[model samples]
Target: MSASTTLWTDRPLLGFDTETTGTNVAADRIVTVALVHSVGPGRENETVATWLIDPEMDIPEPAQRVHGISTEHARAHGMKAAEALDEVAEMIADALRQDIPLVAFNISFDLAILENELTRLGLPTLTQRLGHDIAPVLDGLVLDRGVDRYRKGKRTLTDVLAHYGLEQDGRLHTADVDVSATLDVLRALTAKFPTLGTSSLEDLHREQMGWHRRWAEGMNEWLTKKGKTPDVNTVWPL
Candidate 1:
């Protein structure tokens, strides 16, 4: 569809997320992953797929507490890391190939971790599989920040839901629940910012790249001012 004629709400969206062993995308492992595909208004046409992976590593107490997935449970029921990662990449690659936007609250983290896992497993990264970097991604977090630059307070998934007056019916941090909430927040964002809904997915994706770069630059400057290392990467999608 042409950039000016597209209506984002009318197209399919694939919301993805991962619950990992820790926050370090370079070294951490995914304990669980989820993809929620939805279409039409209010996301009435929806399908969800999820995976629990045996990260084959210790799940830190703090991370386990956040997602409520203990190492014991994962060891007992989760699939091998390589198997799960392969499936996850295939699902995401399929969606991207179809021109559907992959929705995530903070996409860079999940995509980075997935890429690392794929490399570690000797599998083709999503970019390699698709013959290009993944595109037409919709980041609810970036879009919210871009549209509400002056808002005061944290923009965590829960915080964003509360800001948009949406209820979270299930616990946060679980991959599937987080994906569902992310989709709702995206819907609310588009409603609040009509331009976001009307713009083509490619245009929205490019806009978010700029927004993320600007945000990261400002944050890095603040860290430097405080004599702290600037750790934020200015790249989008890792």
Candidate 2:
């Protein structure tokens, strides 16, 4: 909440993730969503909850190749996209309003795409719901890129997981499994960089903003070196 309050112990955090039809955050629909909430004290150690939403869009072959969610599987098992989007937006807004941190891999992507989806559905954008831009946010991908710029390979979730020697119990693309894996990544990064976990939530938020920008710059440089132009808009979580 404050610039001086530690987040890991001061308040709970909501780790979220969404799989989508594609990388167009503004246009692509969320195919699935997951939220893993950690609440209460360390002694109590209660995991609040996790939610899975079936995005109704056809899970394209390319997308399925990454997250492993097939169109038929989602259609048979998923909730309506509009309904699930509303619930996810509301839950995220609640977390922000309550000063709980929202942890995601690439927060800008998830937050931006979520904002677009909410607007398209005539629901409240995250800023409208929280009365400001989201804060007290933690991004494992951003941190990993910032702290491990010279790791010399793909910085994808799987790559980063391997870099940190963390493994997911299940495959990626499924909401709950990915969210849990992302949560593990988040913990690993913070543990590896003690300054991050020790900093106050507000300071950490500001620090991450700078970290993301630096990572973007570094990634762009690396891409240029390989004669490949980086996606300037690929900021986070698509």
* Whole-model lDDT per candidate: 0.90, 0.74
Locate the minimum summed-lDDT window of 10 residues in model 2: 40-49
Model 1 residue 185 CA deviation (Å) reads 0.7
Q: Over the full model, what C-alpha lDDT does candidate 1 score relative to the true structure?
A: 0.90
Off by over 4 Å in 2: 1-10, 40-56, 220-231, 234-238
Model 1 regions more than 4 Å off: 1-6, 41-44
Model 2 lDDT tens row, 21-47: 888877788877777776633324435
TM-score of each: 0.96, 0.82
Global fold similarity of model 2 (TM-score): 0.82
What is the C-alpha lDDT profile of model 1 across 58-98, one tens digit per residue?
Answer: 89999999999999999999999898889889989998999
What is the number of residue pairs that collide in model 2?
1
> Which candidate gets the maximum lDDT versus the true structure?
1
